[model samples]
Target: MTANASRAISWGEASARRMERQFLARPAGRGTRVAEVVAAMLGAHAQVLSAAEVSVGVRAAGVTRADVRAALWDDRSLVKTFGPRGTVHLLPAAELPLWCAALTAIPTGPSPFPPDVRVTEEQAAQIVAAIGEALDGVCLTVEELGQEVVARTGPWAGDLVMPAFQDLWPRWRQVLHRAGQSGALCFGPNRGRKVTYTRPPAFDPGPVPEEAALRELARRYLRAYGPATPQHFAKWLAAPAGWAALLFRELAEAGAVEEVAFEGSGAWVAAGDTEFPGGRVRGVRLLPYFDAYAIAARPRESLFPGEAYRRALAGGQAGNFPVLLVDGVVAGVWHQRRQGRRTTVTVELIGRRLTARQERELGEQVERVGDVLETKAQLVVGKVTVGPHA
Candidate 1:
């Protein structure tokens, strides 16, 4: 049998290695830059802006909320855009082109929009083009974008045909993500409180080919959360299963990836990135809801074993609850409440107990979080009375 079919890798080793790769086994060195951390974590989820800041701040040493904002607005090193699973994310600006190419390469499934209300492929293309022109060198809120698109693409593009947030949205809004996937749009600095969009500033060496982009993206995903199956990748990106399977087949045929036995099932890892950590991961982390590490790790049984499978998960969906990870596995649930300079972090262990040293480590973790957010955090080891997310 080929090494791909015979070599076995266990879940413990996989989880440990993944933790280190995600900068969770330990805080990354002080020199680890914000953009670098964002890239390694496969983009911080930005739906909850403060949570995204905390996600990056807690992982890399010396990275603060100010640092993340500076990298986003000042350095222009990071770009806020629609990313994996069609969620808002903060991706490294330099990789935007490849991200667009790779994401668009995925075979999209049927639209959720009703047939009569949906934009045809041609209409979506027109809206995407109009969005590019409208956002070029200008920042526009959703309302502003809608008006400019109507001017450019006619009344059909401005019809209130799509449903959103218990109300109707413009037909062209359906293609908002398409604009992001085409590298024609991204989030700009917020105006007071409203989110704005802009076309990224031009840079040398434009987007790579779709095939090359998809291949490189697969490799990057494996590097960050490797030994993963096509199903895992598909679920992570909300892509069609058949498409991801074919992509993996193409990768294997090209000798770019190798199949391996993970736990009991078969999985693939990038050919050059099969190395596992030599020791167990030792630490406790309070990962915010939608944190990349909490969302991307596989073998849900192992990572969320026992009570965690019941408590930390929300109706079987991961990343909806702030997880308390012990030695890289979810051991409890936590919630945080911020008031001015002081934040109260509440913990509720479901199945396991931390040793005295682990408790001390948890205290240090709280302090470290305070430093990152520039707040004072108090840790409470009791019932988490607050609701799920902070």
Candidate 2:
């Protein structure tokens, strides 16, 4: 932290700077390689497969949905699995070991399930191991794999049912990501209509010390989204506050990161990354639901000013709505629905209107979005409606 420096950047300005670092602004994302773009952004949110493709396509020049699919399924350059915050994400295949080592190290918070239904640590470990064994060099649907797990672990692994998504979910399903984080599983191509899982060929889990992994994760987070507070890092990673603070302090002492002032509060940025180019970022983009730009940013109040937060987020969840970005700040919420060969994109602008150039750019962006789905898009600008995407 060059604490004595006399520049206090506003949150809006800080966001614009992040846009450049995030590859959402000028010069655009440089590489044709999707892995490079995913690595730069840390990871691409993959809760919605199509949305994840659009996220990467927008950043990388001339990339498309098929390109991303090929990377995941055919070329095996990428893998879709559970990532930070226990959310689905697309990560570069080679970096899986590092991410898995670091992620598996974080202690899981207290169980959400009742004691009667919760799996014990020993049971959970057994289930994880069974999943690894079942999926080795093979693909199986969730139901098919359940039988395998029960055969290896026990009937208890498949017996407990807990409340989730307004329905009863198998207790053993909880360790799905635990298996992924242990280098035991990854998504495979769909079998007709069912999603399947498989093990990465030749993968042998290497020991990555917990503290070293945490330090590396912290360094990568700052490099990608710096000028951030430890609280921001904690919130984004779903890590405990005390642990994040101690980790930040360790990084600061090592000179890997430094503290800086932002609007009267202290925040940390990667060392040697304090310079901010002068001026607002100029662009109009339609970032999809769960796009890393919206999901990973902190101080949501600044990112979604006015009533925009209520409209873009639901019950404190990011990615509930697609976002319209004007100069790197949330301008509105949008929805895209497709039928047959056409897709309708409806954008409800809040208190602001676009200039002629911005409107034209938005049209081009709409075209790009349609290309991702292989459908013709018809854009509709309706009377402003302030609500979350449905």
Candidate 3:
């Protein structure tokens, strides 16, 4: 019924439109700024520092690694925190209040742990509070913070250890994400070689009702990766499908978004943002692992056709190796090896060939990648074996 308001948009058209929305088409050139780029992408993945830097560099033209670092550590304009899917991401610090409020609003259900490892609601609250209090004015390493948490909340917070990935982890560590989502904790600049944590004062505009927060998040997600189904939003945010579907309905009712047909399946886009012009996507790119642009796109089949998805994404996991993009589709997988000042970028075209011009552009992109890393890059075009992310 909602689709009646908008015509069907082909996958090709959608891809081109995404390139524009994602800044892949226009990019944040010299005139544009890094804040705008970060806001547009929603957030840049920062699990791999270099990957995050390259992600920002690609979109925010002429931005150096130092610029990004200053944004995070010095200027504090961008906050490094655990975001979407509980992954490290760089978010505009000014938007932290809204993001924190929205993310905390999502109901995480009851604790799934067995009694032996389960933390009571009261204990969890105390642990979260202790983490906040401990890092109010100073940063502390994980171990140091653990000690502070135990001092504040008592030994129960530290004594409880649960099995996690072959190693045992403190029960209170489970609430680290909750602390970040609550806006009471964030990443501090590394002290020498050790990671540290701090509590950045955030503006809490009182209580942001769940409905309001969900609506805002939904709107942003659509703007960043529109022509997407509610399922995609749910998957991206790790929210319940039924809950996401309900929010979409509310968004449609309020005229905040419009429904479009994506390959005959229903999709939603921010109202008045359904334009998908032809012949927009051009050139080649080397998108680093877990690049926000690559991670946010949905309907995997449309973005990665044939065996491309299987090769790039294994068992539904993305970011094994840097992806090679021809136009807007995944053309191959690539790996980068750096030693001293030289970086080697190895490309493996998976049954896809490029035009001479594209090859040149790819080479230029390799150079740019090197610049992002401050290294001299040597590109190797050959057969690259694909496998799981290390």
Candidate 4:
């Protein structure tokens, strides 16, 4: 923190600066590598893999969904795995070691399941190891992997204890994410419609050490979405608030971070990351479902101001509605429906008005979105129906 810095940065300016840092206010994400975009944003949320590709594509110039898949499966530059909050994400493959160490270092809470259904710590470790061994040098569907895991361990490991969708999941399934966070598992190319799992490409971040890995991860988050607090980070990682607060204290004592006032509240930014961009970030962008910026940015009220505060969020969660961003704030909600070779983009601008020039920019942005998805996009100013993706 700059000692007695002149003035606190307003929430508006802070939001604009974050846009620049996140590559939203600049040229299509400043790099060609899909992994580059993934790293900058920490990870692309991948519960919907196609949406994940859009999250990356909109950030980078000339990149497409195929490019994201190539990085994941062909070039192996991006690894599909459980990342922050144990949600499916596409993380930079080379950073798996660091990601694994930092993620595994997060403090965990007690299980939600009853004792009869719960996976004990010893059982979890054993199952994780079995998962690693079963997927090494080969790709296997969940059923096939379950067979191998049961064979390697015991039938007790395969007891259907966890309820998922319409069926029950095996006891070992609880550790599936742990296996990925331990760098022993990742996603593989789909065999037709069936998904497959495989081991990471044999790189480990153990040399970085957990403490160092965590420090770097903190710095990365601050650099991309900073002037933030540990609570925001804790929420992003689903880690404990106390654990996150302690981490910030450590960073502060080491002089790796500086405190600054953000909207009158004290926040920390990475050391030397003091420059705030001048003027508002003027642009109209249609961000896809689960876009990192929508999910990770701080001060939700400011990000989703006015009517946007209600419409853009679902159950107090961001990323449910595809956002129509105007000058770094959520101004509306949009939806994309792709049929064959064309994508129809329906946007409802709320809470703000646009100039003629800004409206033109919105049209161009819609066209760029089509380019990202490799489809011809038609823009319509109307209500966006929120349901399953069309």
Candidate 5:
């Protein structure tokens, strides 16, 4: 059959189904540690207690701290999922290696700053070496490591270390891989046993060719969020458009991915034609900031409403409120407040008033958020109200 004919399924239906399957697929003994569940569902972004707001989102999704813990430390569900900016997501364990490979391969854009301000290839290599040495047989906080890096790299390096490092962060996986190779770093507790990072313990030095990594990333993208365009992948990876297209083509030629048409948009999917889980949409959701669900798609406007999208992308500085999803569409915005002990949640509807059912569903979610925070919560329906008690 032609590619267009092969992918005639409804996109909305597919997305909803995927959500349901993933949400309900929790194992029998899963614990509710928000970090673990976030990692499992989203990938590498998981960590205990750290990024508390994100943890709140996981809880709002009906996952508990115990569930998250079980998923990570027990079920080993943390893996890597690729999306915007080639960032590694904390996906389930089984999916980790594949996602890692994919992100490692994608080519990135040139530094936005001038070459003098940027880390040169030689400087990057030196920084990597310094980091490896500093981290050898020990875990250091960012502050501590900064000191060590500055000490080792010398005064001449000045503050150039951090700027250069931040710029080179897009390629951090490469340095991490090398550190793992040299026994300088391995996966270990970070941020007070809440997170994991490459630190000395069980570092491996296996070979990972560049071409192979890129191809694998392409395959995983198609498998998880496919029937998408090369531009989508490029936007997601924050990589050069031409390189992303080339990588997509390579994967398609290898039979790892297939070009498919969804609506009028040409997209790609995993060769196996695996379907999403939710199987047609239903209830609303409150997605957290920087959530993969928000970052994974491209031309993001297509997924959320215009006003809501602007608020969300504005980095929250412009009173851009938290989002409220109704049947997979951006329906409104919401916020939370904490005082002494009580917690209050306020939701602002943008268009149609929330139906009784939507209000009840939202209330249930608000309570779930309270349960995760171990605080008493009250839901207040309104528009743009702020205070410790709203």
Candidate 6:
């Protein structure tokens, strides 16, 4: 049988099972950050969270900077986790080599740059050097650092310079990676707040075999977000769709992964037996803006429906509500407003008929937020509604 056909899982069942397992495995005390939990959840959803939905997920998951910091240490797990699309993410540090391997060709090619955006090697070098010098001993914001590079490069810095910088961000990230390697940049104050860059400690600058990297990436992708189609992985990784298919083929042949069928959809899962939690799910979480649960799945409709998905994912769009997930499905949207010592949580559902238990659960969640934020929370429930003003 084809690999994809061999390892598929029912999406909802897997999601529910994974969520239960995670909540139960939550580390005690201030040990693991909510970010790590969120990462694990998304990894369970499969290794990619969308750049758009991450913030919400993080907040809802109650992950903080501290949690994210702790999780970045697994080199193969973390570095490649972020920066897949000029946006940042938390990846398993051990999987970086694989992600970098898969993406190396994309960043190096001519197509990554539009025709209007011209950045010659010399200009790039100058910008890099200026940035390196300016950030050598100080931690500056992007705007501050960019201005310095702009002043040094003059008009030749190009019109699409910011995009170019974004394009070259990974290369620049490598500089920080180098710094991290030399111990020049370790995890600063708050999960890399003090460090000039957000990347974790770097690896030795040595050649990594391309095949091995690809294999590892494929394996991680499957392990974390298995029962997923190759298309799903491609979308999550922001890689060319064909690349995902090829990689899956290579890994499956190596006996690193298998396929499963879930709810009529086909996906791949990790090779070994997986365990999950057995319990009824209940909770109304207010996810942070960049939480992993929302971002990891591509096409989003795989989890959320069509128009709802569009409104949420589209950029320059507002009023896409913060989601309230009930039983692993989007039940309503929530919003939080902070006023001095009080935080008001507003819930607008697609339906007003929430079970009494669901309402109580939601109230408790709001209270939990209040406790965490050290503010009194006012919970307001409203009807199902959508609009720019809603």
Q: Please provide TM-scores, in order, for all candidate models, with all chains considered together.
A: 0.96, 0.94, 0.94, 0.95, 0.74, 0.68
Q: Write the per-residue lDDT of candidate 4 for residues 1-390, one digit (tens) a residue.
A: 233344687766677777776667874544568887788889999988988988888778888888888898898999999999988999998998899999999988788888998887888888899999999899999999999999988999889988889999988888888898888899898999999999988775345689999999999998888879999999999999999999999999999999988887999888978777655688888888878998888888888988888888887799888899988889999898889999999999896678999899999989988987899999999987775233
lDDT of each: 0.87, 0.81, 0.81, 0.86, 0.54, 0.50
**Weakest 10 consecutive residues, lDDT, candidate 5?**
21-30
Model 5, 217-239: lDDT tens per residue? 66655544566778877776667
Instruction: Give the winner by lDDT: 1 or 5.
Output: 1
Positional deviation of residue 376's Cα in model 4 after best superposition, in angstroms? 0.8
lDDT tens digits by residue: candidate 1, 1-390: 123335688777788878788788877899888988899898999988888988998888988899999999998999889999888899998888889889888888899988988988899999999999999999999999999999999998888978999998989998898798778899999899999999976755865899999999999898888789999999899999999999999999999999888888899899867777655688888888799988889978788998889888877778888888888889888888889999988888987788999899899888877878889999998987665554
Among all windows of ten consecutive residues in candidate 6, which has the lowest summed lDDT?
44-53
Give the per-residue lDDT of model 3 (tens digit) for 321-381.
6788887888898888899999999998877788899989989889988887888999999
The positional error of residue 141 in candidate 6, measured at the CA in angstroms, is: 3.5
Top TM-score prediction, candidate number: 1
Candidates 3 and 4, the one with greater TM-score:
4
Candidate 5, superposed: residue stretches over 4 Å from native? 1-7, 24-62, 66-101, 160-205, 274-279, 315-321, 385-390
Instruction: Say which prediction, candidate 1 or candidate 6, comes out ahead on lDDT.
Output: 1
Most lDDT-accurate candidate = 1
Candidate 4 least-lDDT 10 residues:
1-10
